[model samples]
Target chain A: MLARLRWTEFGRDPGAAIARARLISTLGPLIALLLASIFFSIRTDRFLTTENLSLITQQVAVVGVLAIGQTLIILTAGVDLSCGAVMAFGTIVMTKLAVTHGVNPFLAIALGIGVCLGFGVLNGLLVTVLRLPPFIVTLGTLNIAFALTHITSNEETIANLPDPVVFFGNTFRFAGTTITYGSVLAVALTLITWFVLTKTVGGRHVYATGNNPDAARLAGVRTRRVLLAVYATAGLLYGIAALVLVGRTGVGDPQAGQSANLDSITAVVVGGTSLFGGRGSVLGTLVGTLIVGIFRNGLQLLGVAAIYQFLITGVLVILAVAVDQLSRRRQA
Target chain B: MSAVAARVPVLEARGLVKHYGVVTALDGADFDLYPGEILALIGDNGAGKSTLIKALSGAIVPDRGEIFLNGTPVHFRNPLEARRNGIETVYQDLALAPALDIAENLFLGRELRRRDIIGIVLRVTDRPRMLREARAHIADLKINVGSMKQSVETLSGGQRQGVAVARAAAFASRVVIMDEPTAALGVRESGMVLDLIREVRARGTPVVLISHNMPQVFEIADRLHVMRLGRRVATITPASHSMTEAVALMTGAASSQGPTKG
Candidate 1:
């Protein structure tokens, strides 16, 4: 009798229905990732090889790191269009300072990261103090950072980076496959971010601020501070992404990462993090990065044209957003 | 109840004034909430009840006012300060994060940390403990919310109100001020909220209820502090006045000489 009552309760409970919806959202990307992997392995003989898998991880390292920052900003219902430009600028700062200006590599790295942090703070202050929309603020900074990168590098790629600068790009054999330190760093950062978002008070505040800023403020949350912290933290991650980029290419290419801003956003969206904010996980972002990596790599092995990758990714992004909107409408 | 005037008011305000350009929201409004009583604050549309409540709850800084808690003058620069001083408020919108779960919403700003080093050094929240305490609080109020882990957006309107009230009830050490908590609820849900208010008063914590519902106010409030033209017009109990008289005082249809002392 008790079991029957419990079953009826579960069937009728709105909370149960909502919980099921949440589960679907959280698991959707993982299932897609696995299915895509299986499909690729069947289509292309080289798709499952460790060499190609390692290469995909290596290729996604820089964008994956940038996605971490993008995920943080987007989780707060904000976007950073300047993340890629800021990262490109940071690489120039680190590589030029170390190779041309002959500053200590570590200090140059710190200075590079510091510059990104400043941009984050600048974006944050403009959003909070000036009360500007994040999209407009970040859009303005994108051009500024892009111009700064060109001026700093003088439209030149700085090469012959110091060993420490390229350390993350160095390869190490693991499980009979070559893996880059940059890939390891990207995964590590994702794990740490996942822990922070799930286990910390600041994480909760971020979600709350994104969900409803007025409600958060009335509940005694310093929503401005929370937003500032999120942007600044994202800036710090961008700086780290700059390091990974420099290490991967062994040069500071001023022209690199031009499309990375949208790419990182694509990964976040595809991974199941809502563009509207207040509901997402960084772990989902990791899965999303892999999904993009797999699709591009798989298509390449299938002898598909490069431009089709862009078309497919664009379609995936729209589908993810539509799903998010549908789920939100259901809840409403 | 007649002898309640001898005790110092738990929360008191005098000559509070607030202006938004040409519009004056609060013009020298005075308020008093005694210990362990549901004080219903009633007024017409533009009578400045919201502005007065904002000042008392620290949502806004009044242009001129003196607010006292237990006879001690207090200035709250923000809602956080008011909350720190053991005053909790449920705004008209409920002020709850819809995406957060029940336990998370219950302890939004003031989350509990584990006693161990992981929580201390890493600043991790004690989720298990918060969930347990949240369940206990909800159960104490006799609200039948199925799971504490369900996000507030998924809950029914009444359940969401229950979470807000439960949060205020759990943390409010001195006073709980609610602004039209039952305005959006159905009759049954409103009855549940009224019972919750009475239960809070029975627990010896005072409540300042702002509502336009005359019958609910008459049924629950120990005293009615009527407002007209941004000032306290009278303080009448259900025993001394009818709902018709209360409405008259609220809408300026009847004249009350001054704020009547018990």
Candidate 2:
């Protein structure tokens, strides 16, 4: 029945060849991004400025790193809802140790990251070993991590961190624009993600596991291990995002990461990565993050209201998913 | 049995038994496949044909039974172990990852890494070599795929089946087992698969075909093993028994001809 359906769909022509069909499905968001950029530039003189572009990069750095982790998990047909909560928790650990306890800055950062890694491992164990649904596992962890953040810090923000905690916030001028090391770190991390997912056998296995896990097992992939490792690494990325958060704000704020989880997902979806998994790229996720960043920066420059900004972002996400679904249906 | 039936069997299973809760999927089933011949395993619903093949393919473990390859006793804990032992199965679903390229699927689990330092340090796949070798293999199989770079999901049914069989034929040093290879295909695509099975035999490896299509089975299989009620009730030659007689034997109408223990 599946073969017959496919055959009839081909006979119908549908006005698109296979190669064009593939290209259009994958590149539709990219073209939209270009059009959005053009429209924004026409409306505002500052939109295409080097300073504004670097500012957009700086604003998106934390989400960019978090989205990399999200992309990996999504590639394996999983999601990480606890990333924002986990990041907030990691920041508390780092700030409390570095300021409240007067611990070494590096050691404090390590402890902060350790807590995030623990959450990641717990998510992985629950999903892979216990065979729990990923959605439920991560949902439960998100709340647990959030509650832990408040209990650990007693709902207090740690301020006045040392210089080392703010190292990533260090800036250098290039081509008449100030660029933070954090943005560079985000780019470097995205490149690493692209290489790992594209070049290595493990990366291919991730795609395979997402595409058809039983087939992957038949082909001898350790799918459980792959999923577990992806979760653990995502936790590590959350930890990194925490430090970037500290660099940007210069204070350990527990209330800060509430929007991060939603934002990172928005970026991932906007970049063309599918929630269905197995057919997206990390670089596309980077583009997604930029799209989110550009839209926010553009809307703010145009003096749009906060409620309208939120509504627009929500609509964009839904539209992107609808486009993806329609394209896939057309292929079928 | 062929003229050289006395020679060592490539793969043999003895008294394989499996129980799924209260259901007995296989009961004291036995099978043997000699080299360079196609053995068709046919049965009605729930007659343990799949169970027996699962034991051989390492998809299922029998409660009691032993398997031997080339007269050496072997125990396969999973499908990977079975693959390493030179046993590959093309399941009824044609277990191929739809999003991956043909070259990637052809070497899915056993990708060839670069020989230089990058392979050791970074572990990059040697794409150039695998693509070239995969193209040659596909051409050798006479599979009319558009490109090795195309994902398997885009190929037609006959082409995809050909790829699956060719994958097994390329890797199976001892035997290839296909479970319902033609069940989902139309008549033309089924013909393509039948030809591929013949090509596999011609390439010097034996095939164990588990299919329900009687005409397709009779056309390719050199021998037939029939099962009923989770047991092997008959092993007959299609040349000797008519299709109706085979169906009657499987449906419990005709008297069981071969050894019950076999």
Candidate 3:
């Protein structure tokens, strides 16, 4: 529908050329994902099976949710290095309250999300009020969240979570293949976020703020408020990611998600969202997350070493960013 | 033109005093903008012309001053407040989000929301309505940017200026203050902006234009407000003063003939 609208409006509008270019850019990640899947399928019959495909979706659930939040932050030309640690802290809070502190399961979940929201607000206040660089502020909060997670959980893993906490982790059969509710939630959240970003006033402000903050401010956008809302909203998404994490692992492990910060960022960049901000889409991010999942699954199926996967992922990230820079230069 | 002076000023400022910690940017500046006239504010680089304009447009709060809109004292806490009172300013930088389309830029801060449940619940903007209105606004100003959907960055320097001016003209019911609207444009583009200013005045909105381009100022402005040493030194009409005399008054080389009045 969007493409049709663009094409219909293309008459007598020279801007259609640029709009076409953007459409191609958005499709870039999906193309890469399809090609990668084809290569893996050709290499190993196991790669094409429903079992392995469902496994990939299950594996991507947590990181997929994390990437949603990451996409929002990166859209504002900001990065949240604390997202992974914040999710870990939230998971611990939820599990500890329910299992150890005997808090109501629903209240425990809300409190966990609230704690994550608080951190987001704190990050926002420091960035807007003190006017600190986002990199430095998030870096500080990253360490703070990491420390708090360990302190609260006592460097231990909490298992046997209540039913409500583990609800999303449970599997349901769909078309003869098992699917986790967490995966559905991740995809749902992505669509909701995409709607909010594309169809609302707040979404436009996010793009405007990222594109040129001074201009946005002069145009009557309360840019500081926009930034604050973005950080706070991203933080809330991270807390939801924590729930997905607990569901998948069935344990609140303090040591989990140590590499998640970089992983989620990798997904966003690979999905074709610009790290410079204001130009990418969450739908692209969905493709990006799958791309990462496919590569890891494909490599493992092909008997590549676990360590080799890290090397390949690193190379992919740099390549994606290089493509972004080249395209930006061309636009300039 | 003489009858305009007898009417109450649409926008007026008295003794606007602003200091920046050991440096006074605006020292007791007084300004008056009458209805349906182009008042060009001209001053040298450090003569505090921008500072005085900022105070009136709500970009900065003056330490000591009173501003009146339609004879009613008004204090603007920010640019949005000024805008709510029917005053708009086009900053020197143009303040345009380059990645956003011209229609989006026109409705950047003050987007129109849909009136239905979709808008009420989801807060979805009335994008189609905004696009229609934006096209009308741009067309009314006779700007030929081709498409309202094109991002501002894709437009040429002159086209961007047209977008900025058109925005001010569309929303400003009482006054439009433009700070060097043509400083970055080519000669042809500058002339187009001067025409835009004239078109704005034709619609009965008074304009407060800040320009260093003396010829353009004299060509379009009805009255010239010359600032020197952080205050209005003289208010002269093009009929009464030459370009050389305006420059001299702006640089403190020539003294006013008498106490300055609007």
Error of 2 at B71 (Å): 1.0
Q: lDDT tens digits, residues A54-124, model 1?
A: 99999999999999999999998998899999999999999999999999999999999999999999999
For candidate 3, write residues B1-262 as lDDT tens digits. 4326668989999998999999988888999999889999999998899999888989999999899999999999999999999999998875798789989999999989999998988889999999999999998987777778888866667778889999999999999999999998778668777888999999889999999999999998989898987888889888888999898888888886523454
How much is the lDDT of residue A165 in candidate 3? 93
The per-residue C-alpha lDDT of model 1 at residue A29 equals 93
Clashing pairs in 2: none
Docking class for candidate 1: medium
What lDDT score is found at residue B78 in candidate 3? 93
Candidate 2: segments with Cα more than 4 A from true spot: A1-18, B1-3, B259-262
| Better candidate number, 1 or 3, judged by TM-score | 1
For each candidate, what's the DockQ? 0.51, 0.45, 0.42
Say which docking band candidate 2 falls in.
acceptable
Candidate order by DockQ, decreasing, is: 1, 2, 3
* Candidate 2 local lDDT, A1-332, one digit each (tens): 45345433433343244456567646866887798899899999999999898888899999999999999988888888999999999999999999999999999999998899889999999999999988899999999999999998899999999888878888899888998999999999999989989998888889998888988889899999999989999999999999998998899998978988888888888777778778788988888888888889989888888778788889989987886677667656
- The per-model lDDT (C-alpha) reads 0.89, 0.86, 0.89
State the lDDT at A305 in candidate 2.
83
Error of 2 at B106 (Å): 0.8
